[model samples]
Each structure stands twice: as structure tokens, then as C-alpha cells.
Target chain A: MTDAPPPAPPGRHDRPLAPAGGAQAVSELPVVTTYPLAFTGQAGEYFRIWIVNTALSIVTLGLYLPWARVRQRQYFYGHTWLDGQNFEYTASPVALLRGYLIVGAFFLAYSVTANFDSTLWIAGLIAVLFFGLYPWLVMKSLRFVAASTTYRGLRFRHHGKAGGAYLAYGLANVAAGLTGGLALPWAWFMQRRYQVQNAAYGNAHATFRGDVGDFYVIGLTGLAVGIGGGVLLALPLIALFFLLGGANFPEAGGETFTPGLVAGLVGAYLALLALYAVAWQYVRAATLRSVLNRVEVGGVVRTGATFSPWRLVWIGVSNALVQALTLGLATPWAAVRRARYVVQGVQVRAIASLDDFAADAAPSESALGEAATELLDINLGF
Target chain B: MTLPAPDPLSLSGVFFDGRTSRDRAATLTVSAGEAQLRVDGGLETRWAVTQLRIDPPVPGVRRVLKFPDGSRFETADDASVTALEARTGRNRALGQVRRLETRWWTALGALALTLALAWGFVAYGIPALARGAAKATPRSVLATFDRETVQFLEDGGYLGSSRLSAARQAQLQTEFRRVTAWAGGGYPYRLLLRDGAPEDAPFQLGANAFALPNGTVVMTDQLVALARSDRELLGVLAHETGHVTHRHGLAGVYQGLGLTLLSVAVTGDLISAGTFAAAVPAALLRNGYSRAAETQADEGAGRYLMGTYGTTRPLRDILARLDREDRNADESSVRGGSRTEDLLQTHPGTAQRLRHLRDIEARGR
Candidate 1:
């Protein structure tokens, strides 16, 4: 169980589905039921919503931004279903608008100060201030997002302490800095663990049992592949150029495949891209499997994810290329596809009955923190 | 005794009491203009149809209705929602959104229009607005930026101490002034000379001459050395002066800022970290001015060369040499890493710039 599992071969067990309601097993027997999460969003459907939102937002000079955000969130959440019920996003746009305004005002004041006096000191001061506020903001954002996300009339909740958030974010930052950024994997794991342990679905608190070693494995592999593969990819291009007699050949070089500088350069670019894409895929797949499977809700419901790194990488590279080529018009389709792929890979195992569990919706959190984080360009919850 | 079929259209759904998470089967009865809910025959609630609060339905999802007392009803059944909508009237905004989603052709048209409008704004509207904003800004305000940037460069070791002797500096200054004398004393032009960019270091903004918004031009020692004649150096200075006189530097900054804000406004996607990440490269690659702006600058350089040297030949010659120098130095091996490494040069390619200069000379009397 310590080693990461191999790619799940396609079979009845490969893609998990929820157990049939009528099925029964003996009381003494151990039961492992897999519940498949579903994303039913369609690109064509989302495009209409996006186009209208974009048009209206521009028409109103960005005043419709909050509403647009809410609509988009609602669409995505509403389509994500587990056990015949969907999640709901129930935030008030007016609150988010207020948060944006406050954040805007703060930036305005800072800009004025920066313009009139020494910018370096003022910028440093603002950075320090934001760093101090980071933990609090992350905590608030988590609570707000969790409280607003409803499933079957009950909102998910976060019970994590502010101290924990500070430990996760603040301490991680210091540690990463101290290690000259080499402690990134450890820091990432700690932050993720903190977030996961504090999550609650209905009445059950979540727990994370993942180790930092897994993160390092993925990180080291990514780094190794990035460097080794880059060199290997470049070697062929260089050799080809020398063989082709385009430029002066190396002292010991023998033959050239294609003797043109243009060919060699283009080939080199494509090879490098391939290496990067593959490296990123491996890291992403390994990380997702390690992180998600370790998160257990209510000590009964656990998640499982198994994705083919090569396939995931292919999707990512092609999706980016298509979006760029289309000048972002295909963004809706690409986003939906990516979400669908990730969601489809997830399987939830519940050892106990999930239908009877319940938790009351928490009171709405303040919008000020959420808005301020946005205007500060801090990506907290996405 | 069918009893009018129990209205036949009563809405059935799931009900929550707001105090508890237990879900119960619910039926919504609209009778006598009141919306009544009977839950598992255990709890009953009613509100006037007009007074009931309804959360707009997302397509293919549950519609939630809330009573003033905090209890709520939700159901994914389309028929039930339709019945409720028919009784209380549909939410106009959601209705429009739904219609747009279903009307494929209309959505397609809107998307096309949006893209067209965005392109138009980026290509034409932003530049025009930036020109206006630049003109409106005071020179003193722009000068503050100039001082700060130059100070920052000096502090960072990017601007090394000037290595030219006083006589050589004075000679070059005289030549610059003599070439631009036709502009008279009204143009607030100043010149500064600095060492070449550092070698074997990260920051490699090399062998460059550029203008600040405040009518100040910087020429590097490398650029001076690259010039075979004083006429060539003066030609470069005249070009930098054109940038200052036209306020292109300030306009460029304004255009970049304006486009970023406009992109956010149009997309309404502030939370997408990719939005900002993508913006950085766009700004870097868009550093070059439009063809028209570059042509204007080149013409300005040609005009100066003609006035001072009696021909634009020196400017043309220097441009060709610079083109050759660039070709020799274009050995940077892009490892296909960050997009910033491949950012388009802020000036036109040397060939294009030379062609434009030749065009200017051909048209010059």
C-alpha cells in the first residue's frame, strides 16, 4: 500500500460506479463501495453563458463581474453530481462587489503613496503587510467557500484553526525560504494536509494520512526528467545540424540527416516542448493520486484517483495549443473537458451510510476578505 | 368525485426545515394564490405566491424556493419547476440566460461579435486612447518616472559609469544637437551616455538606445562603438528624439495597462490566475509599436540625416550594419522554456526597419 499503484487497466474495476441500492452483504463482511462523481457540463451550453456574461460585463464596465462570477461558479458546481445530488454555490454578488471596492481603494491609496515618495520602501511595506495577512485571508476564503457550497441543503464546512492556517502557509514560506526553495515539496504537502484535515462534509470531518516523502518522489522525478529529457531532446537536433553540413561540423562528427539550420531549430523546439509536457504530466498525475487518495471524509469515505500520465499530458498540451490557436474562443470547451477528465477519475469509497448524514449550513462569512484577496491578485480559492 | 384532479399539476420536491438536514418528500400546492408545502405529512408551510423567494434555476439543476421563515424547497423535476414558474412567473434574468444557452445560433453570433470587438479594441481603440492619455499627462509627472527608472538602473549595476572622455562626449553632444537643430530650442531634449550592458550576467538588455517619456534619450557605449561614424550615432539619437517628441514611450505604457484592464472587464474572470499569467507575456510581446508608429520614427531619423548630412545615406548605412551585427549575435539558444524568452522585439526586425528607412529617403526631397 505504500507504493503508488500502477495504471489501472480498463475493466469493471477500472472505472468505479456507485453500488446498487438494492445490493446487500452480510453484516460481518467488510464492504468497499465506490461512488463515481460525475460532471455533466457541456461546452456548447457553457459557451452561451460565457458569451452573455462577457458581453454584459463589458457593457456595464465590469460592474457585472460579481454576478458573472457567481453564474459561472453555479454552472460548474451545479453540474458536478455525487449520488444523484449536485453541489450549489450560493454567494451574494453584492458582498463580493463590496469586497472588490475596498480592495480597490487600498490599492489606490498605495499607488498614490508610491508615486509621491520612495516606491521601494512603500512596496516592501505593502508586501510585508500582505504576507502578514495571508494566513488570515486564506482561512477566511476557505471558510467562505466551504460555507457557500451546498449539497442536499447542507453546506460543507471548514473547522480548521487560524493557527493551523498560519502554520501551513506562514511557516511553510519561512521554511521554503530558509532552504533556498528546496523545501517546496515539504511545504506544499504541509499546506495541502492542513487544508484537507480541516475540511468537513455535512457532519463528518476529513483527515489526511499522506506523507511528505511521496511529494518529494514526485518533485525529484519531475526535476530529473526535466533536465535529463531536455538534454536528450537537444542532442538529436545538434547532431542533425552537424551532420547536415549546415554550419561547421563538430571535429569528430560523421553524417548529417538534414543539413539546414532552420530544420534543426524547429526540431529542437518541438522536442523541448515534448519533454516539458511529459514531465509536467508525470508530476501532475503522481501528485493528484497521492494527495486526493489520502483525504478521508468522516473516516469512512475515501477517494481514489488513477490517471495515465502520458494521456493527461497529451490533453494538457493539446488543450493549450487549441486555446491559443483559437484566441481563447475554445476556452469553455477546454475547461469543461479538463474538469470532466479529473472528475471522472475520482472515486469515493464510503464504508458507512452517507444518506443519513446531515449538517446545518453555517452562517455566511464576510465578503471583504474574499474580495481583498482577489484585488491583491492572491489566488486563494478557485 | 375526482375533486378537480387535485389540480393535477401540484409540484412535488424535496424539503428542508433549515434547522435540520433531514430531507423529506414534499408537494407544493398552489391554491387561492398561496404556495403551500406539505412535508411527509409531518410539517406544513405556506407562503403567498408573490411573497415566496425563489433562487433562480441553473439549467439542468434543482430550483430552490425559500420561505420567509428560512425553510427551503428544492427539486430537479422540470415539470414541478414549470408549474411553479407558470403560477409565479419566471425569473426574467435566468430566463434570458437559459434562452441564450438554448439558442445555439444566437450564442455563436454573440461569441463571434465579442472576439471581433476585442480585436478591434486591441488594434485600434487602445492605441488611440493611449495617445490621448499621453498627451494629457504633464511632462513633470513623466519626468518623475524617468528619474526613478534611471536611478533604479544605476543602483542595479545595469547602467555602468560613462567611459568616454570629456572631449569625445562633448563632440558627440555637439553632433546630436547639430542634427536636431531644425527642431529649435522648444523641444525639451537631453542626452546621456552610459557603458555597455554587463556581460556574463542575467540582465542582458544589450547595446540599446531608447527614449524616456520626459524627452531624455540614453545611448550606450556599445552602441557608440558600433557606430562607424558620428553621423550614424547622430542618426540613432534623432530616432530616439522622435520617440520623445511623439510621446510614444508613454503611450506604449498606457496602451498596455488599458488593454489588461479591458481584458479583465471583457472576460469577467478575475479569479483565473491564468488571466494574469497570460497577460504578462502579451504585454512583453506587444512591446513593439504598430507599423505606422515605427515608420514615423524612421522618417524622423531620415529627416534629420537629410538636414545635417545633406542625405539620408548615413542613416541607411548604419541600419544595414546594425542588421548584420544583429544576425551575428542571434545565437541565443531558446530552450523552449518561459514565453518571455521569445518575446517579440519592441522594434521591427532590422530588415523591415531598413526598408522603411529607404522608403523615407526615396520620398525625401
Candidate 2:
């Protein structure tokens, strides 16, 4: 069909349940079939869309932003396939436009008031108000995104409560602060649990069996790798700096730019960049694998991901370098490559047929929460 | 809406009833302003063709026809759907957008237009807006901002009591008052001498003078020590006076705010906006803005120096000496300090400033 599908590993999907087709019999063994997620978006195609969107946004003075965002998301979701059916994004742009206008007005007022000394208190008041309502907004955003996304004609739902969100975020912050950020992994674990456990596909609520200890392990390991690698890389660069006569350069009242100094600085910068990329990608890959492997939806489908931390780190660092060298013109290609890698890593193991999942009554959600959260750069990913 | 009766087109696809994930092999036929779906098992459904909600075309992606009551029929037969849409006349504008998106030439044109518009906005639009906003800011607010900034510097240990003799300090303060008076004294100018060489501070202000909003000028003790004569010190005060009179401090703040907002908006997402890729251009643009401000301040100082001393040699000499000191510091520091000076300098080079001052002197003569 559409570009030969990656061959599913034999033993992974070959574990057939008892030949009895009854629901009870299937539930006993649980594992029936594995469906690998696929992303079929092309970089050239997406590049055209990005260019058109940018032009139209500039032409319309950003009034077309909501429409552009919806279109972009639709493209991404529509190309992501699992079990021969693609996902869908069905949020109305008009609804999003309303939210955009409100957020825009709030942003403008806040920025303007914040610039002047006399009006700063008003800005502070607005900040306090925003902070107080952040949990509610996050809850609403989760509900909105879930309701807007559909797969196989069934919408995902979010059942997270505002009070629960407040408790999760508040306690995490307090704990992290009290421990001088040593409890950051615990905070991240809590946040991930809150996000995952409240999500559902159709009527099947998700459950996260991931352990908090795994988060600490990943975090500590990432820290150690980052520091150790940075030092290891720095040692040679330091030697190079001395070898290049950086120390012998004029100590006072002379030209600052020497070939040795430039070379040393550049080398150090690149080394630091490499270390950061490796550490960041290591944590990301490990956390993603841990979470995905432990998540079960409806107790019938178990989801898992396989990503080699080093391989992912390589991809991330190279992607950054490509984007930087291209002055952002390679953004579409980079995005597609990353998406393909991530999607290919995910597998869904289902005990029952995909057709059995039923739709939940869609909850009506205002787009304001999504707009507000996106503007504030808050991550509410499930 | 009325449409001519067109030949019925039959398309085979999978249909979902919206209540569950169950799919049916079905055939869809559109004719006489009505769409009918017949499943292989003989289940039939009908809806007015005008009631159909068709998703805009994405190339190589399946076209989905959303029916009333949340049912949907998805098919890869895009040509058939385009013919059906042509007969129905819906989503015309979105179809055009899709057309534009699929064309190579249009995309190239869009890229060019975006680059031009972005360049124009950064080069001209933002500075104009910042200028207007800075002018609109109230003097009282500026004064409060200056007071808070000075307090912050003191609390952060970046500023300390000057070590200069009381006689020297008074003499310099008198010279600063005279310089401001010579420059028409448009602002309530005040001078503060501070020690800026705290090893623990995040930034060292060696031999530097800065003007805050509200006409407060801070001169470091090192700058005083470096000055060869009171006339050289007076020339430096004249330059700081120019910064105060032109409201460059507030303008610079507003410009920074504008640049941040513009970058966030242009990148269309916070993630890319935060990336190093987007930051470089913003940094370059900010440098351009500050360099322009510095040139303007230099020109203003040159005019005042020419009027009072009949020559800009004093100001030019002090600038050259400061530049030399900066280079010396950079050379001594093994860190390759101010590495971005070539691309991200916030001030015009000392040589350039001297040439401009020389031009002003010739014009005065």
C-alpha cells in the first residue's frame, strides 16, 4: 500500500491468544496483536504548507494564525497512522480565533502595563490572577485537546479534575523548592502520572504503572553524564587553548582577536553544545520509554516505545546543527524526521479488535484554555 | 443553493458511524444534491449533499467526508471528491489555499515575501514603535525606574561607594553640571560616582559611564582615574547628557521588549523561538538598534563639545583610550572575552565614532 510498512518483528506480534474468540478468553492472555505507529508526512510537502502559512499570516497581520495552526496540526495528525487508520484533528478555527483574540488582548495589556513603572502593580495583579487560574486552564486545555483529537472515529477524553491538577502542580513545586531542586525528578514523575492516568481512549481510561524510582534514576544518570561528558570534552579543549598560545597572547593593551583564542572559544562552545544535547536527549528518551512501556489503556491495550538513548541523542544534536546551519529553512525536514523516528518507536498491543472501542459523549470545551496555555508555553502533553 | 443535476459518482471507501470504531465497506453515490451510502450488508444512509462537511485537501492524504450526526466516510479517491466538491461549490477559499500550498512557485514567492516583510519590520517598524512608546512614557515612571535600578545594583553588590577624594568628586560633579547646562539642560540631570569593580558581581563595569532613564548618570571610579584631564571628563559627561536628553535608556528598553514580542510572534511557536536558530537574528537586530542609538548620542555629544570647546578632540581621545582599555582587558582574560564583538557590538566602533566627530568638527568650522 503506502510505502512498504516496516516489517513487524516476528515474536512481538506472533503471540496469538487462545484461538477462542470470546471476550473472556481474549482478556485472559491479553496480548493479541501489535500495531506499529507510522508517520507518512513528507518534508517537501510540509515545507510548502509552512511557507504558505507564514506568508498568509504576515499578509493578514496574524489574523490567520488560528487557521494556520489548525491546518498544521491536521496535517500532522492526519498522517499519523496506527492499524491502517489515521488520527484526526477537528478543532474549529473560528472557535480558536475567539480564544486567540482574548489571549492577544490580555498579552498586549500585560506587556504594555509591565513596561511602565506606574502601571507595574496592575501587571503584577494580572500575573497573580493568571497564576491562580493556571491549574484550571491546564485542566481545560487537556479536556479541549482530548475532545478535539479523534482516532478510528472515537475521540480521546481527559478526565483530570481542576483540584487534582492544582494539588499535583502545587505540591510538586513546593517539594522541588524545599529540596533545592533535588526533588525535580519526583515533580516530573507526579506530573507525568497526572497527565497519563487522566487520559482515555474512548471508554478505556489509561493507567500508568511507571515507578517514581525510574524517574530519579534517569534524572541522576542524565546529570552525571552531562557533567562527566562536559569535563571530558573540556579537557582537550583546555589543552588546545594552551597549546595554541592563548595564554601567551598579550596580557594588556593589545589586540584581542588571536587565531588561537578564536579556535579555543569555538571548540569550547561546540563541546558544551554537544554535552547539552546528549544529556537532554538521554533524559527524554529514557523518560519516554519508561512511561510508554508502563501505560495501559482500558486494560486491553498496552503501549510501548523503543528508543536507544544514544541514537536519539545523535538525532537531536544533528537536527539542531542542521537547523542552525540552514538558518531555520530546514525546519520542516527536521520536524518530519523527528516525528517519523518517534512514531516508529511506538507500538500498541491490543487484546481486542480496534472496532470495539466506543465513543464518549464529546465534552464542549472553550478554546481559551488551549490558547492561554500555548501562549504561556506550558506543556500539558499526555 | 441550487446545482445542476450531475452524473452520480460512485466511490468505494470505509465508513464509520461515529458511535464506535466499527468500519463498514461502503459505496458512496452523490447525485441530485443528495449523498447516499450503502454498506455491503445492505444498510443505507442518506444526507443532503449540501450538508456534508468535507475536510480541505491535503496532498497524498485521504479525503474525509463528515456527515451530519458525526458519521464520516473516508476515501483515498481525491479526484472523485474534487469533482464532487466542484459540483457542490463548498470550501472554495480553502481549496484555493490548498492549491497555493501545492505549487512550487507560489511557495518560493511566499518565502521571498516573508523575508522582505520580516526585514522591513525589523529594520524600520519596531524602532518607530519603540520611539513612540518611549516618548509616551511618563517622566515620573522613568524616575521610579531609575531609582529601582540603582537600588538593584547596590543590593546586588555591583555598585559601591566611590574611592575618589571628596575634592575630586566635587570637582567632577561641578563639571557634570556645567556640561549639562552647556547642552541646554533639557533633563533633571544628576551624577552618581560608584565603584564598579566587585569581583563577586555578575558584570564588571570597568571605566564605564551609563545614563539611566530619569536623567541619572552613573560614572565609575575607574573611568575617573582613566580621564587625563577635567575637560576629558566633561566631554564624557556631555555624552551621557545626550543619552539622558534623548531618552535613549527608555527607548532601548522598549525596543528590547518589541524585539522579544516580534521574535515570539514570527517564529509562531515558543519552542522554535527559544532555539538558538531564532536567537541569533534577534541578537543581530538588537545590536543594530543599539549601535544606531550610540551613533545618535555620539553626534549629539560632538555638537555640544564643538560649541563649548570648539573641538571634539577631548571626547574622541577619551573614547579611543576606553576602547584600548577594553581590548587590553579582553586580551588578558583567557576566556576570549567579548567574542561576539564583531557581530553583536551594541556600540559603533571607536574609530567610526571618532571619524563622525571629526566630520562634525569640520562642519562647525
Where in model 1 is the C-alpha error above 4 Å? Answer: A1-34, A101-117, A180-185, A211-281, A303-314, A368-382, B1-9, B77-90, B148-187, B193-209, B219-238, B259-291, B299-345, B348-365
**Residues A67-171, candidate 1, lDDT per residue (tens digit)?**
877888898888777765567899888988887777666554554456544565776687678779888888887777787788767779887788998988899
Best by DockQ: 2
Put down candidate 1 lDDT per residue, B1-365, tens digits, no spaces. Answer: 22443353477777876655566789987765678789996788778878788787565556788888777887656556655665556676766666665567877777777777777777788888989998898877778868887887777778786688899999988877775565443556677888757654347555678778786778888788777788878888888777777778778777766665664553333344235446654565366444456667788888888766777666666666665564233212111223333245555665566666667667776
Tens-digit lDDT track for model 2 on A105-171?
8777888798656789988988888878877888788888988998878889989898888877767
For candidate 2, report its TM-score.
0.84
**DockQ numbers for every candidate?**
0.27, 0.37
B22: Cα error in model 1, Å: 3.5
Best by TM-score: 2
Residue range B100-197, candidate 2, lDDT tens digits: 88888999999999889888888898889888888888888888889889988998989889999999889888888888787664667889999988
